[model samples]
Target: ILIGNLFTGNESMGNGGAIVVKSNSKPKIINNTIVNNHSLYGAGIWMSCSALNVVLQNNILWGNKASESGNQLYLRSTGSTYSIINNLLEGGVDSILFETPYSGILQDNYMFSPEFADYATGDLHLTCSSLAINAGSVPVVNMPLYDMDSNLRLNGSEYDLGAFEADAAATIVSQPQNMIVMNGDIATFTVVANGANVYQWEVSTDMASNWAAIVDDTIYSGATTSLLTVNSYAPMNGSLYRCIISGNCPQVTTISLPALLLVSNPDGFDENPIAVSVYPIPAYDFVNIIHAAGSRVIISDINGRIVADYAALSSDNEQISVSNLNNGVYFMKITSSNSTQIIRMIKD
Candidate 1:
């Protein structure tokens, strides 16, 4: 989050003031007032990657002109997955400076001017009758979803273009898709997310309390499948479990609702509908995850670095390897298409 504030006569301020982010990393720049700041090269923002994950939101990026290279704002992240959310990239030689941000979701925003007198005087407010009104996407992350300045985001149509709006009510959009699994086989859970990269999963022990993140799910990653060992252990009978998923796509963190499952708690009668069971809460070396069928398995270190990933697990009560691991905690995410079961391991 870098903002450029300078005192200059000409529009271009000679080099720098440009933003740079390399691949294999995720970053964001928001709500900045960059005017009169320029560079001979990439001034506004420059990114390069075939699969970049970033977001630009509700920023007044204009005036600070540049040329010879890069857009007044440019995009080197062509073919990458980035977003151009609600913002004002206007007045510059070219409004939006990008390469072809064709991946992430693009919504309502202004590429032209909302007519501001000057930044120092602070009259950048938008008029209700302005052309920038009601011209943006309904689902943006950080354009101030709520109109603290009495805009139209609270009670009105989908969304407004610029920073200020008429209504101020904001809502988050996340696709809560149900995952199904076979009674005895393993499965995987996948979601196509944009602007977000990290993910966390919460377990619901009590129905009343929305859902508490499983204590150690904060380091999880989004857009990937989680493994659940069928022959693993779970809570008690008649217990209800839900997976509350959330992550950082860009600036907007979306949670994938909850996928529920009921344990086969023997109501004093019989046991069915039960999936799998993993044993030894704190096993030293060998842990057994036995389900009616088979499942995939994954082993991630404390920092959420996947050290081991395997598919098409063996039959029920499969033999797991905890050798070559230090003495500490590790997360083993096991899944089948229907549900995901995360387990903790202790390697001595």
Candidate 2:
């Protein structure tokens, strides 16, 4: 599926500067922006002598120039069939050249100029007043869930034509923040995004080397909602958490920054626990640990396996060599006389 893409800034001395589909190539071109190409013939696309089915839907073909022939599309095939639907063709019907006995379905297509945000700067995002809005047919198959800018498609009552979906308030307004929760307490992280978005909570022990989706289990609930709640436990200490926000459009996935979860045992801890910090989050060869001078540090993996142990000689910041370790999430447990704290660390 050729979906949710932009094809531009191309020039050819001959035909089909942007695309040329020859015989036996049954490609489905959907939700694409093809613009500003120059060629002798078929500046945008050319299909010649194909014996298979060619599908083109929800595409934007604009600002293409041809020297002497077809400006947008040139179809010259005797045995091929096509389905061209719900596309915004800026060029008129004369821009397309079809052979005799044109066997294709052409319905709900538009020929008006699609008012792009900035055609000169190649920013083809649709404005609110664009005619391409709500001018498309619903797809039967290969439907994209998101639009070009990771915005949810079908945000309106119907699908919009062209590559981008016009939305004024469809964006991630706020992201989840980091939190510190006591063991056995409830930890909640919330995100404030707009539009018809889908949310999935994920946890990674190793900075973000690998992420596992959070399901609606006993310990974790509200995994699919904007707010995610987790019943904190000792095992959940130092685990990194984040949310994945996406829409129905293809390739419209966004992962938020990792939030550190520090699970403290409040019952046995002193009034003031030792302050600690670790960096650089995604460490390559080594990671620096800043903590109390007499603290003892232990590094362990998510499986509770101890990887390294160190004793701080002085309060001076200590650096641990992690070049031999594989890239993944690990926890650094710093223990002092009064309290213990686990900090999440990642090896890159």
Candidate 3:
């Protein structure tokens, strides 16, 4: 598939000043700009014999000249089929030269001026008032995600009928900041971006190389959203985190700088402490705290207000119901016979 490209400023002697499709090749040519070329036949493009199944959609063909015939395009093939839709042609639909038995679907093409931003300097970006805006067919199958300059495609209500999409820019508004938290504390990182974008959070233990994408599971969730939360911090939580924002119009993608995550042992907590596990960092309804039996658990919000207090009576695992709590950061204090541990939890 030849998608999202620009071809211009060429001259040819035989045929196809810019592009010539040979036999047995089925190329889908979409969202391209071809202009200012001269040739004997098919000044802009030519489909030779036996070139079967060609698709030309959302393209701009203009300012091409032919010595004798077929100023913009020439098709000479009996086995060829085409799908020509939502294109802006210079000399109208009559500019195409087709041999007998032409087989394909052709509709919704424009023949008027395309109103480029700057035609002299080859700036083919469409103007706001151009007729090509919102003139393309709906639901293009296998359409390219980005345009020629890596901007996003389909900026408006539908795809535009040219190489460049309408006015759309993807940019990051607020980057994720560095964070430091105590062991077993809940740490959250967030990024804010504008435009139609997709978010992906990644973590790197070795300073930016060998990054791994975070996934939604029992331990970690919201890996694809703007917010990422680490439910319980351990020694391994002292890594770098970053977010990638992409899927803008004209197809541009960008990544934010890695932010540091420093996980420290709790105050006065000894090394090699009791093993405790917490699950579902951004807890929606409940949070599970697994520890030794007979351990006392105290939950407090950011303001040191005690919310829940319980003791592990019969088993080492306890499920604390937090469905009534608002969304914020909370702390948990677990005290055993020989040790005490403080954990951070997030209620969503």
The best candidate by TM-score is 3
Off by over 4 Å in 2: 169-348
148: Cα error in model 2, Å: 3.6
lDDT at 258, model 1: 40
Question: Which 10 successive residues of model 1 have the least lDDT summed?
Answer: 223-232
Off by over 4 Å in 1: 1-19, 28-34, 49-51, 57-60, 85-87, 91-110, 117-122, 140-158, 166-348
Question: Could you tell me every candidate's TM-score relative to the true structure?
Answer: 0.34, 0.48, 0.50
Query: Each prediction's Cα lDDT score?
Result: 0.49, 0.77, 0.76
lDDT of 1 at 6: 21
TM-score of 2: 0.48
Error (Å) of candidate 2 at residue 90 is: 2.1
Over 1-348, each residue of candidate 1 has an lDDT whose tens digit, in order, gives 332122222333443345656665565655444444566644665566565657765555555556656534666664577766766666443555555545675654566765553556655554444444444444434444345454334233344443444322222343433333433333233334433334445444332244454432322233232321222123322112223222321222334534333333223423343456766756666777787245678776544567777696777768676766777756676766555565556666
239 Cα displacement, candidate 3 (Å) = 43
Q: Write the per-residue lDDT of candidate 2 for residues 277-329, one digit (tens) a residue.
A: 88898999987777656888888765557888887636558777999888987
Residue 108 displacement (Å), model 3: 1.1
Task: Give stretches of model 3 more than 4 Å off.
Answer: 138-141, 169-348
- lDDT tens digits, residues 193-309, model 3? 787367889887643446899998865677988899886566544366778676433333457656667666644445556687877898999877787578888776644577888
| lDDT of model 1, residue 159 | 45
Model 2 residue 242 lDDT score: 78
Q: How many residue pairs clash in each candidate?
A: 50, 6, 11
